[model samples]
Target: MGISENINEILLDIKKLSPYPEKVNLVAVTKYVDVETVKEVLKSGAHILGENKVQVLTKKHDELWDYSVNHKWHFIGNLQKNKVKYIAQFIDMVHSINKLSLAQEIDKRAQEHNRVIDVLIEINLFQEDSKEGYDYQDFLNDIPALLTLKNIKIKGLMTMAPYTDNEDLLRNGFKKLRDLKDELNTLYFNDSLTELSMGMSNDYKIALEEGATLIRVGSKIFE
Candidate 1:
């Protein structure tokens, strides 16, 4: 199957999962797909492409520009502060914003790059020691510091739900992220926090039902 087939399948699956008619975004995670494959995907009406690493995105981005294809570029991995300037030059959005210091660094670098950075507040809602996010209690604390960043806008929340077959946990984790996203928007102190980037190949259906505006899927589209 190719990009069109994969996109059609994901869309049909999303439509079957919810009745709200939410325009879910399918970011053709390009961490694995090659340039020719990406060109084929672009021909299939797929625009948004996600890259998980700064170096990989820079390399692929340079390669893609040679094809003269204009598409949204999203950085969906851990971003180091030192690389923010270079990363900001290519990416349209960053989805792994986990700390205020990083946010501040991104804001500063984006200013130098003359681009306003759109970032998602990543939440380790499951509290996995191995993962990163603002904890439940520290949520309020994170919000204020985030608001202080002038060049960066908080678009929404992104999270990595615990790897589990338990449907309830999966659903609740997504719901929690939605609830947080809504609350951040309600603060009104900052602008609207609308985009929720959650879910992946295995649990995207549940994530969409809970209002995931952006889904970073890999294997499903890669195949």
Candidate 2:
């Protein structure tokens, strides 16, 4: 199937799971794909494209200058402090902020650009050695300090469930993220914590069912 067909199929799936499909953000993961492929997805109405590396995002951002005005670019990988400068001016949001120091650096870069950068706190639900994010207790303890940052807005939470054929495990991880988001809202009295950036091509349907506001899909669409 073509990019358009794949996107339509994904949208249909999202509709089946989401109470309000219009509100759900579909971010197409563009890492490793060429600019032409990225444009193909964008042309198919996948306006939000996520890139894992800042250098790649910068190249694509420049290559797709005309389309950039119409689409949103997201940094969805392990962002390094020095690399933050590359995306500071163009990235629409950062979806992998796990530490206060990284958040502080992002804020500093955003300050330099005179823009407020939207960010999601990545939660390491199972403390997996491979994933990067804050544990529950650390997140809670850092809330006050996170709130003190002026240039970064705490949008919500993001998590990557273990890649498994087990549906139960997938649902559990996504559920925890939703629960944490709710808890944080009540504890912090911040209603802006609305986005739940969970799920990918493998388990996005489950993610939607569990209340993921932003679903990052890659291979399925690109294939």
Candidate 3:
């Protein structure tokens, strides 16, 4: 199938797997694809584009500026403080705010742009040293401070499950993140933390089954 067909199939599967399909956002990870390929994704009806690197995202954002009227650009990777200035002007939603200092930098840049950027606190549930996110326990202890930032809106939580084909590991990882989101919402945000940004091309169905509000799919459709 082509990109459009792949997207259609994924969207259909999302509706079948997700408890709240209407609220679930399908973010097509476009980090590996080029500008024209991204255009093809937009044409496929996948309007939310997710990119990992700042330089690539900024370049695509400028090249695809016309599509901005109908699309949203999401930063879905480890963001640096210095690089925040590059995409701070129009980043639709940041799905990888992993630390307090990073959140502060985003807040400062968002203030300069006079915009409130929506962000998700990334949690390294598996505590992998290679992963870029707040450790599970650290995030719990830091939420109070993270919530105090003025220019960035804390949307919810994001986590990447360890790369594995084991269904139990995938489900448990996604469920844990969902549960964490619920716990934080009840304890602090009062049900405001609605999004669970989990899953990717390999395990999105499991993520959706476990209540992921945002699923990032790339190779499945783009490759």
Q: Who wins the lDDT comparison?
A: 3
TM-score of each: 0.92, 0.97, 0.97
Which regions in candidate 3 have their CA more than 4 angstroms from the true location? Answer: none
lDDT by residue for model 1 (128-201), tens? 99887767656677776777788898888899887789989999989988887777666644547878898898
Instruction: List per-candidate RMSD values in Å.
Output: 1.8, 1.1, 1.1
Q: Which residue pairs show collisions in model 3?
A: none
Q: Write the per-residue lDDT of candidate 3 for residues 29-147, one digit (tens) a residue.
A: 99999999998999889999999999999999999997644899999998989999999999999999888899999999999999999999899887788898888788878878887
> Which of 1 and 3 is the better model by lDDT?
3
Tens-place lDDT per residue, model 2, 1-223, is 8889999999888899987787898999999789988888888988999999888899999999876437989999999988998899978999999899999999998999999999999999967899998888998888889999999999999997888899998898899888989988988946779899999999999999999989999998977
**Runs off by more than 4 Å, candidate 2:** none
Task: Return the lDDT, model 1, position 42.
Answer: 74
Candidate 2: lDDT over CA atoms?
Answer: 0.90
| TM-score of candidate 1 against the unseen true structure | 0.92
At residue 220, what lDDT does model 3 achieve?
A: 95
> Which lDDT values do the candidates have, in the order given?
0.81, 0.90, 0.91
Model 1 clashing residue pairs (backbone) = none
Residue 223 CA displacement from its true place in model 2, Å: 2.0
